[model samples]
Target: MSGTGRQLAVTADEVVDAELVDEGAALSPAPADPGATPAVHTDRDRHLSPETVAAIEESVADSTRRAYSADREAFAAWCATEGRVPVPASGETMAEWVGYLTVTPRKRTGKPAGPSTIERAMSAVTSWHEEQGHPKPNMRGARKVLNAYKDRLAEAKAEAARARQATAALPSQIRAMLIGTDRSTLAGMRNAALVLLGFATAARVSELVALDLAAVEETEHGYDVTLYRKKVRKHTTNAILYGTDPATCPVRALRAYLAALEAAGRTEGPLFVRVDRWDRIAPPLTRRNKDTGIVEPIGDPAGRMTAEAAAEVVERLAVAAGLSGDWSGHSLRRGFATAARAAGHDPLEIARAGGWVDGSRVLARYMDDVDRVKNSPLVGIGL
Candidate 1:
């Protein structure tokens, strides 16, 4: 089924040994059925070995299975230390046992596992136990523990927020980033277009990279972009926003890029294409030759750029502009918001322009020196 909730016809089905059992199996403490009891068979005849457990996990997604495997391994080690049964734990026993994992020093890191990590371990083990037809431990308490951990994280973020009103590249810094780009060449033009789009729209690096040739339209007022999906929210509609009135900066930058793209004879698809410094069309960086300077067409022309690629573009531009430290792609988005507010745009107006769900989230992220200066003591004290 798709997210629209429409079920598609199944073409084929693969059989697996483990079946998804009833949800009640996790809480029920009795055998599956009360009908005429079949002859009891003890595991002494043919016990399920570690190899069998590992094989069962192979059917799940790689990430999910790895997590479950890690959790089970941790629990098995704990069982060996406590001299308890290495299999299905009773409700009371699991509660008592998981409590120690919260404070127990990790064997590798030699630091106590945090509550959230421990809770995940418990959830994994309980899920496996339930799958094997054993009554699983109560998990409502685990949710409470996880919530408390989340609260701590929230508090930490709040503390950091107090120390810093959002900081982004200043006007001088933005000017520097632009000057740093090699504007004499096609590569330079592409880089300029990338940065300009990000700055004008306050777009995340993901959104900027996902743009297709068809999505951009030159409007009478300015360049209007239609982004299909923005990470800031969950929606199916296109994000329509005017890039600046008259859109000279972004439009000029884009025109240079498009001219280069057309000259290279790519007219029908992606808005951006990678070109090497030597003017050769090459492939993406790979493990074998990642350091070999090559630019390849990204497979998904409308998909987000790799975080590494985005960072590289920003860092290179920042270095060109004569700044140091890890200035990443995100700085452009932050740069736009900060610059807009500095220009005296209202908070709600800025938020609306930036496609923020509300002004608070925008304020929380973009509030900075401009905000402080505009509302500062010096502004009104003399009068």
Candidate 2:
């Protein structure tokens, strides 16, 4: 499928004026035979591929995909077992499947299927239907059912949330860890920069990972970085909607990080590159033969710095500070909100700082959870 077309010509000045041309062509493999029709080819089949369906599922967080994938496979298997065509099912079949699922316990969660779970399963199937030229299921009715189920889920989640202890690094812990690190080493400097940037910017893991060297900008207002969050959509011409905040966007730590990167003469490409345990440029490693295998040198690492990696960085820093609990990248973001609230920063200011479209929404969802400082009387203060 890849080739270059070239023409060769020979020229002479005073000799017999003549032209000779030779053309080069690449190997062309034979077209694939259209075998017996596939199990799920509809008029809209051209709009989607098996891989597209897989990618859509994968575009969610990694762990969520695990459950969704299982559900998808189970539904597919049930259809196969019943000798039903694997094409898009009708609304009646879907309703029947939902009914069956309500009674059937989930293989992994080992609980009677809840409405929210069923809704997600239906969404997956619904997406499949649209991809295969069938009409989309009525989401409004599905949402009503989902909302009714969500009430039950909300009660369960409340109990769960109560048990889920708040997880975030204390200011003392973060400060101690940052000061304790030997900033002389590249890794140490990078770690310090990461901690500062991670906490100050309150960025998502994907946003931090997407940063390029050029994205970090220094202006009179302080310093700021441009990050394309995963969930945002691009415009018609594929231009990013660059949301800028003032230098208060943790420009200091980011500037320091950039300085170090510049001193090392790395001024382009991904701002965060991999360094292995041995301090070598971490080569691309793939999960092969039940073991990690390094591939020949490639442009980038084997994969993006996943959320797990971002979480691990926080965990390591937490351990350094002798802290515990589910401290991860998310905690860092939450920490920013908590700390900002504790610092008497305006909720609207914090929202704008975090690059949210609406400050009110962030105030309602994130900042509202900030608890008042405990034991203010324990510390000595001037009367």
Clashes of each: 0, 1
Residue pairs that clash (backbone atoms under 3 angstroms), model 2: 223-247
Which candidate should be chosen as best, given TM-score against the real structure?
2
Extract clashing residue pairs from model 1: none
lDDT of 1 at 73: 74
lDDT of each: 0.60, 0.57
Candidate achieving the largest lDDT: 1
Output the TM-score of candidate 2.
Answer: 0.58
Q: Which stretches of candidate 2 lie over 4 Å from their true place?
A: 1-70, 78-122, 133-173, 176-182, 234-252, 280-306, 342-349, 357-363, 371-383
Tens-digit lDDT string for candidate 2 (44-129): 63454555545544445555445545666777788787666544665555655665665666666776566656766876666555
Q: What alpha-carbon RMSD in Å does predicted model 2 have with respect to the real structure?
A: 15.5
TM-score of each: 0.53, 0.58
TM-score of 1: 0.53
Error of 1 at 14 (Å): 32
Error of 1 at 228 (Å): 3.2
